[model samples]
Target: MPDAAPVLIAGCGDVGMRLAALLQVHGQRVLCLRRNVAALAPGLPGFAADLADAASLRALPRGIRRVVFLPAPLAREAVAYRTVYLAGLANLLDALDEPALQRCVLVTSSAVYGEHAGAWVDEDTPPAPLGFNGAILLAAEALLLARLGESRGVVLRLAGLYGPGRTQLLDDLRNGTARVPRDPPFYANRIQVDDAAAALAHLLALPDAASVYLGVDDTPLPLHELYAALAQQLRAPAPGIGPPPPGIGNKRLRNARLRASGWAPRWPDTRAGYAALRVDPA
Candidate 1:
């Protein structure tokens, strides 16, 4: 990493903005990079730099000591995942001009744990990806860690993200797509979008941050229970009980490590996060 104080936020989006604000307040200069420069909020220091296009990233601001890469996939398929997550990181690293870059933070997914079959997962668990998303992300994670030799790379495996403007779960319940699986319950884990941002900032500030961390909230609830609660709140018909669709399974994720570090989520559970969406059923 560079000896300078410049921080690079690649693929800056909602979480990126949160990190940018924290870094700025701490008296560090920050640069935001995304595929579309116009999407960047006004007054933000950013430019259009696509990780797919290594050429465009060649001119990324120098003197960057730390980098946080959090890019959304361009498509839903495996190929798209490869392009954005794997190829993107490869291209970004290859194009960096900074030699003082000390640490690179890569935001991945808990899907990499695949079928833990209702078992709890932590940072040290060996990843056994069952699905394509998990496999690809695991591949990308391996690429980043190997490239940086683990010491200078941190992989944050984020759970499902939700918050304001991210009302997909609420929408699912309202639209009757929410399900209540029978005997076997599919466990769900998550972290609020805001907390997701805060976690990244917290990791960046730590001098001895672990190379891998599970970014999850305090509670890991069953999908059936979560849906039932949401349905009752919305005064909608309770979701019908049925078997889970293929590819979904039960798995609990623990964030004891993150909480022990003094970073706690503001919305710890379904109740706290969805309380606002509880419209009067009258």
Candidate 2:
């Protein structure tokens, strides 16, 4: 493939836009694909095509060298996930000329680990996904590798993402609506949105990127402790004890492999990250 070939970002959204900005700073040619071209920023080169509709993808730009697939489903249902992650990914790969493509990175979630109960998980951990989302994503990961070869496929299993406009946790804490499980100490892991975008860009430039990497920050605090700290930061009343959040497996994600690959998070700890948000809204 020629070096001039554009890097295609499938399912372009918040993280995709951030990654595109990073790549554009370095003068890399970026092409974005999404359902709505109008939603894209002012001058970004993009195409409007729904991944669920195979025929719509036929008109995509040709000879794309690399891809970043980080699509979000229309809803939180099983059918939505299957359509977007599994069938949508399949349609994209099939539509493209696979021979000329160098890499296709998929942004999946850590839910694949499924209820670790405060245990630690790494990329090497065998996936035991419990919910439909995780199971379908695991299947999508397999499909990517099977179609594009393992060496050319990359999977980023990201922890909870929070930053910028994604401040629901902070809002909940401020209004005393936040509730967390405290008896068993449910763990929470996350990466700031900027850091998550940086990680995606890092993998794109990595020459010897691994097949799978965990996208999480350094600290994985217990849910109650994290909520308490946020409450303290906001000077609000602490959240009441309640049940753990559904479907999110309780495990501390280890990003050792990704860190070892020469990538580090700007926000290693959520406390400091959240503190920055307090000082400056965005």
Per-residue C-alpha lDDT of model 1 across residues 118-172, encoded as one tens digit per residue: 8888988888887888899899888988888664788889998887678776777
| Candidate 2 local lDDT, 1-282, one digit each (tens) | 225888889998998988888788778888889999899887688989999999999988788868999998999999999999999999999999899888889999998888788899999899999888899999999999999876589999999998878878888887889999998999999999989989988887788688999999999999999888888888889999999998777889999999999999999998899888872333
- The TM-score of predicted model 1 comes to 0.91
TM per prediction: 0.91, 0.96
lDDT of 1: 0.81
Clashing pairs in 1: 1-100, 1-101, 1-102, 2-100, 2-101
Badly placed stretches (over 4 Å) of model 2 are: 279-282
